[model samples]
Target chain A: MNRFIILLLIICSVLPVFAADFWLTQILSRSIILGVMALSLTFLTAYLGVVSFAQVTLAGIAGYTIAYFSANTAGIGAELPWVFAVLLALFFSTIAGALVGLIARQSVGIYSIMITLAISMAFFYFTRQNYSVFNGWTGFSGISAPSVMGLDLGAPVVFYYVCLFTGALATLFVVKFSSSPLGLSIQGVRDAARRVRAIGIPTSPVIVSAYAFSGLIAGMAGILNVWHQERVSSFSVGLGPTIDVLIISVIGGMRHPLGAFIGAITYVMIDTFAIDLISRDRFNTVIGLVLLLIVIAAPEGILGILKSVKERIKKIVLN
Target chain B: MKFFFIVFFNGLTLAALYFIAACGFTLIFGLMRTVNMAHGALLLLGAYVGYEVVEITGLWTVGIIAGGLTSAIVGAAIQAYILGRYQGDELRQTLITIAISIIMADLMLWAWGGLTYQISLPEMLLGGVRLPILNVGYSSVRLTLMAMAAVTGILLWLLIAKTKLGIIIRAGVDDREMLQALGFETKKIFVIVFAIGGMLTGMAGVITGSALSIAPGTDMQFLLSSLVVVIVGGMGSIGGAALGALLIGMAEQYGLAYAPTYGVVFTFVIMIAVLAIRPQGLLGRSEK
Candidate 1:
């Protein structure tokens, strides 16, 4: 597993040398950013046995915070320095994630779905209706990527590398975190809250901290996303993105965190190239049908199907 | 005082719409334990179908019936064919329904275009009337909406509380295994309930078309509200749906009136409060 991830990372890092500009910007960078967003959900699902519909919302919050603090064409946010903007964005989004955890701490499974969906939708509506900070329907635009700390992110390849670096770093963090004492307890809570509580560990704080950690993961992607799109709007954080993140997580398979990138690449490929297979307008239809088939055929996602198929092949060969 | 009453009427009008839409949602969740996220799509389908029927036939009643019937058939088909395959896995079911919703929404958008359509009301249900005491003139169509909500609630109560099907449904809800062991076809009962729930939503969609306008995103708006309504009112309780709708609708309208920017926050706040104070919801039974 480690070898596979390292190999994947190597392939990603060097691909910019030969990859087309379109693929680098449209597919690679976008997937890395979206993969990180989906990573947040998958982490909770893989470890915590809960799915949050607010992963996109958390990312959006981070994106919005950066948008609010940075200089923009919309001229609504305070013109904070790039460094402050980035840090504050992550900080705010992480805190927002913890708050979501706090509010929905008790609910599990389907109940968490309801709470998270409501929270995400409520944020969507708030951004659309509130003109003061979010700038209402037409959110901030005319934002450009700022180079910082000797890195030139203005170049597509450079930005893609940054996204890759961030994504890989996050993946490493998740892998390490899952084996830590706190992470094990989180898994314990996911498996049996009653048993975990019987061991004298408070469950809510563990859950809340997990959410906060996922928030940081999502916030990193959110910051990159705003820089990639050069704008942050209500639409970015709306139900569309919210569900898209969930779909990516499911498509990648929920078992491993790295599956998010696999799912992200697949989604981005389909979304971009489906125009050739069919009309561009019917993309949603195509994607929905794909998701439905995946859910029905392999509820654990593509990774699960691969694992089972591999096991079957191994069994046949052994026999 | 006059302004308060006006806002109050507005709230009631919105509440009626919400209750009507949420009825089917609560019903499906109650019997099948499936969230049926595609409910809003079903409602939108009914609304569009109703509009087309009314446009061709020039009869509002026919449009309403046709809309309801179409949604009923579709809803039953979905449950019986797709959702029934995975009976007890709520998460998988929810994901499937969500996929269905996305497909339906996209397909509907393809067929209907992005234009908004409002179902024209019958002459009798048109126009407005001045309230006797408050002197606030409200749309007659809105009044009819409230009336239809009441009718839906009462008739649903009768079906659940009085009828044999209702008894079986309640039994199924209480213990699906026991109900199945008792030789009852719980699957068939689930399809029936889905159909009934779909019918309620379809009619509500038609009524909503007359009361307001619907476009591409209307499905999502109703879906989110239904989620909140059922969550607040209790998962599968008709009375809870009504109460939840009323509170949400009232709070929403009042917030919009008093603080346009923070209107949505009020509903969020209320939901959080309910979850904090009563995780099972206001009238919801505590989970075992």
Candidate 2:
């Protein structure tokens, strides 16, 4: 297993360089960003039983903030340095995350899902119409990427590494959180809110914190997402992206943290290749059908299927 | 006063339209405790049927009936065959239904491209009638639609409150175990309820399609509306759905009327406010 882990890491590191000739770099980076978003969702859903439908919206808010801040204030020649702009974007995104958490954490079950969807839709439409700030539908272009101590930050390969590093950090944080006492408390709250309350556990704080954490992760993904697109539009964070995140989380197996990474890869690959194979018009049909099949077969997602199969094989071998 | 009347009447009309769409959604939700994400997809299906009818016969009434009936049949079949088997599993049911919705939406996209198609009402039903204070005029078709909705509501109310079948349904919602103890096939009841809900959503689609315009993303938009209605109305309450629909309808029209720019924001604000204030809904009965 240790060797396999090293081999897997080696493969991931070298594969991007090999596929750099094609659009695989973009694909991998997207998968990573999407993976980060999916990881946040999986953490919230699995531990808290909160299937927030606003992960993409949070991402969009982060992206739009970055774009807006990075907009050339000084007549295209100078601006409030890339670092400040990025910080401003991150701060705004955190606030957006907190706001979403506060509002969405009020209700439970499907009602909460609807509330998140509504809020996200409102944000999407608001940004789409408010041209003065978000530049309306045309969106803000020429938003430069972040550089570390004056390194050329505009390269796709550099951006990919940035995504990789953040994605890895996000994944590690989620795993650490999941095994902690806090994670257990969250699962406890989800499993039996009444019982937990009876035992003097404050349920609301856990849920709110989960939402905030999820938002922070989503915001980070959003920053990376804007950097990837280099042009943020309302279309970037609408129902389409929202649904894609849901599909990735569910398909990857919401049971485990690693499932997000797996689901992100499959969803991005399938969505991208499906679009490449056919036109954009028929993409949803194919994606939807795939979603249906995956749900029917593996309700726990791809990870669930893999685990179940592995267990079955072990049982057979022992017999 | 006349302008007020116009907004009020328009709001009611919109509410009536919303109620027609939400009835099926709330009914199924009542029994299943599952939000059928595909209800919107089903609405799109009915709209397509309407479109096909208009293309085939060029008669508005026939198209409406054909579209509604097709939606009902499809709804019934899917519920009876697929959802019926997944009784008592809310989470799995949600997953499956979402999948079904996606598949249906895709199928609709394949069958009818992304272009928007409008079905014209008959010449007789095209214009509005005048009243004293306000021109209270609208497509006669909408009037017919209101009448049909009223009839459906009355019948559904009777079925839920008056008939033996309705008693079984109520019992099923209150306690499936006791109902099953009495040897009633709750699964069959669920299937019937789901079918009826589908039929209602289909009818709504046909009416809405005729009233406005049916397009590819119509289902998603309707689904969002239905979710708002159900959440605002109370998940399992029929009356709640009607009241919720009316509120949303009024809010939407008035919001759009008052500030055309913030029209979309209005419904969302209401949803957030309602959920925050009364998580259950105005008329919703609390479940233990």
Candidate 3:
């Protein structure tokens, strides 16, 4: 599986050169960024049994921080070095994630969703209304990708490579973390919190750490998101994006890290191509229907279905 | 003092609307433990339906009833077809409702064309009433909304506190298994509760449509506010909903009056504070 993934990443990195399709590269990069965001959500949902609607919000925070620190049209944050700006954005997002984790510690299930939803909504409104800081609804622009080490990172190929590298690192981290002691304990808590607690595992910190780690991943995605778009707007971080990421996470399968990328690819494909078949106004209708069908038919997502098919094929071969 | 009174009255009216919308949410939560994310979409549907009714009949009251009934039917369908199968799985229920809301929102956008629509008030409630104490004019429609909220509140209170159905609902909330063991058709009760909840949300939607305006994305705004109210007042408690509404409404009014840009932030700040201090909410009983 690891070799297959590495081969796929290599193909993805070079495909842009052979095809030279700017739009395809853009979509692929977007899918990678969204996949990273969904990976964070999958990390929390798969391990902690917590479905947070705030991953986008955390990403938005990082995006805003990037917009602030870089020389942007909005001129909010000081013009800092790109590395410092990215690091600070990640720091803020991690802190925000930890705060949310602490706030939602006592609640489980729907209560946690509601709390995170409220926070996201609050951030959305705040950014929309506060003209001085968020530049109102228009948001900040003129945020080009930073050049580093004598390489023009703003070039599409380089940026795509950046996204691919970051996505790969995040997926690897999640895969390794899932097998770690803390990750196992968190999963144990998801299955039986009381039993885990009785067995001498301190569950709350584990949960909060999970949130922070997810935040870090989401923060990296956020920085990449802003660099990709060359702007940060309130719309990107609003309820729409929040739900979009949730749908992506669920559509890919919450059980495994690869599901996030699969789901992101599906979502980006639909988003990119749906306009060809239908009116722009009814685009969401198609997406909604697809999501509903997936929820109803394959609750475990596309990966789960593929896994089952693989299992059945193996049984047939044995027979 | 006059400014304060005006703010207070405006806050009270807003609180009344919040209470009406959130009570149903809390009730549904208390009984079914299902977080119907589609509640907002249902409210928006009610507003749109009510707008059409008023456009046709030119009677606000008729529109309100039609809207409520339409939303009730939709809500019942959702509860039966989608939520009913999920039972106690809150996560699946939440996702299902989110999907339903998305579909409903797209349908609404297609029908309404994303324009903000409002239902006209009746002739009697068209203008403001002179308040001698405050020496100012207050919108009669707002006063009527307060009266409607009071009536709904009283009726809901009676239904829950003074009826056998209420006892069953309370019993279900306290212990679903025990209620099931007692041979109560709890499924039927869930349907009834969902219908009533939908009706209340629809009615609130129409009222809100008349007073404010309803657009494609209004459902999310209303949903967020109702969630805040429920969180502050304590989920599944009528009195808690009322208190939460009052606090949120007053805070919003004052924020709008004093700091218009940050008006929405006040409710969330209150919510976060409540969550930090008492996760159970102001009037909610802590559960194990």
Prediction 3 global C-alpha lDDT: 0.90
DockQ of 3: 0.79
Task: Report how far off residue A104 is in candidate 3 (Å).
Answer: 1.2
Question: For candidate 1, lDDT tens digit of each residue in A1-319?
Answer: 8898888889888998899988899999999999999999999999998889999999999898888887788879688888898899889888998999999999998899999999999999899998889998999987877877877785798989889999998898888998999999999999999999999999999999899989989999999999999999999999999999999999999899878988999999999999999999999999899899999999888899889999999999999
Candidates sorted on lDDT, descending: 1, 3, 2
Q: Once model 3 is optimally superposed onto the true structure by TM-score, how far is the C-alpha of residue B141 displaced, in angstroms?
A: 1.1
Ranking by TM-score: 1, 3, 2
Per-residue lDDT tens digits for candidate 2, residues A157-200, read 77777877888788778777877887788888888888988989
Per-prediction TM-score, please? 0.98, 0.93, 0.97
The Cα error of candidate 1 at residue A296, in Å, is 0.3
Stronger candidate by lDDT (1 vs 2): 1
Give the per-residue lDDT digits (tens) of candidate 2, residues B1-288. Answer: 776667777777787888888888888888778778889988889878887888889887788677777777887787787777777766667777777887788778788888988877777777766665555665566676667667777888898999998898898888889999999988777777777787777778878887888898888888877778878888888788888888998998888788877777788888778767887877777766
Worst 10 residues of 3 chain A by lDDT: A17-26
**Model 1 segments more than 4 A misplaced:** none
Model 1 interface DockQ: 0.88
* Clash pairs, model 1 backbone: none
lDDT of 3 by residue, A23-45 (tens): 54568888999999999999999
Positional deviation of residue A83's Cα in model 3 after best superposition, in angstroms: 1.0
